[model samples]
Target: MRNAMWMQGVEWLAAAASDPQACKREWERGAGTVLLEAGRHWDVVSVPRQLGLLALDILWYDPLRTPGPTLVDSAAHRVGFFVPPDPAGNWAGADIRRASKGSWVAVPPPYRSAGSVEWIVPPDGSGTLHPPLTLELALRQANKTLAVLAPVSAD
Candidate 1:
């Protein structure tokens, strides 16, 4: 039963793919990850690994503030947080990249977390996503924290 529930959640996420059936087949064939288009079901905000970890920590510290599905790409040294589609695409940051509308993102199976790209937080099958405003605040706080922790350069 638990496995079924997990698969359901994964299916919900796979539905975002251009061809949901093909995506699932890839997973069944043992593919580590598959590329999915953004802006249809959700948008992705990718940040540097360090900043993403800090932001994730901030968001997860409060149980009620838990974020939506997030992915970590070790090879790219980046992390992606899923948020609802924003037609206006109003997102900005020094090292942040927003994958919306015409963009693609690599997504791992919800159960896999030991690969170049893996899930830090997997979807729960309820179609829940991070609130854009809340994520923005967390990112801002994380950036400020990083600024404070950065080593000062000697003249």
Candidate 2:
């Protein structure tokens, strides 16, 4: 049941990546950073060229989803969610942790951490634009979309 719901999140994330105008801004310091907003979530996809790495930060708001206690902060409880990575590579290769926390009763934090979603893609805009029906495929395609959206440089 949880996995099915997660697929919904993937679909939503992909739709956000498909929009050309969804890009809101570029970071002054980050070379390949781009901000994307769609629906109720804000995603920051970053490509650090120097490090040859790509990362995505998605802030989702859904009062209907409740994360497990060990997945988030102790104070966080209720409808909010903070998904930890899956060590078994079930979700994407990364897993959620003890420090991760969320609360439906309160607002989520304003910061992103290593625990956030991570993936890789080519710099060219050669990714599948349509939303993937599965989580793993969605992660791959979303990373590809990020690669296309990420700035080549500070220019």
Candidate 3:
């Protein structure tokens, strides 16, 4: 049941990647060194570029089926890959403690950044790129989309 929901998330992520305009703004805001977009089930940590590898598992997704799938509501659980401000760290803020907490499911910190990455086409959520898309660029896109979901985001 959870995997089914995750598959839906992958579809939504791919649709978002398909939109240059939406993804562009999202890219710039995330300060992502790279942005990779694929189907919704993708996790940034899985990327070769992601610091420790910020893998996000889509616990749930609600789609509307237009311009491709989009996430109406979703849940994700995150695993720590890197520590922030460490350059090698993919984390957003502060440090990981013995007892970390969040409003959503467990994962890495969502950040507000000011750089951008672009994708030529959408991948199906393999966390790897295809055709015009590249792995380096995909990481940047992931950060942007993840940023959009930040608790204080305008997106």
Q: Pick the candidate with the highest TM-score.
A: 1
Compared with the true structure, the alpha-carbon lDDT of candidate 3 equals 0.29
In TM-score terms, candidate 2 sits at 0.21
Better of 2 and 3 by TM-score: 2
Q: What TM-score would each prediction reach against the true structure?
A: 0.92, 0.21, 0.18
The models' CA-based lDDT, in order, is: 0.85, 0.26, 0.29
1-155 per-residue lDDT for model 1 (tens digits): 66775697789988998788988888878758888899999999999999998998889877765678898999999989999997344468788999988998888778776478888888878888888877888889999999999999999
Q: Which ten residues in a row have the lowest lDDT in candidate 3?
A: 65-74
Tens-place lDDT per residue, model 2, 1-155, is 54554444334333333352332222122233233332233212112221111222221122442212111222221111222221123332223111111211111112221123222211111212212122234345545766688789975
Model 1 weakest lDDT span, ten residues long: 86-95
**C-alpha lDDT of residue 54 in model 3:** 27
Please give the distance, in angstroms, between residue 55's alpha carbon in candidate 2 and its true position after superposition: 13
Candidate 3 residues 1-155, lDDT tens each? Answer: 54554454334443434454554455445444223332233222223222113222221121421121111111122222211111233323322211112111122102221222222122223333221122223345555666676689486
User: By TM-score, highest first, what's the ranking?
Assistant: 1, 2, 3
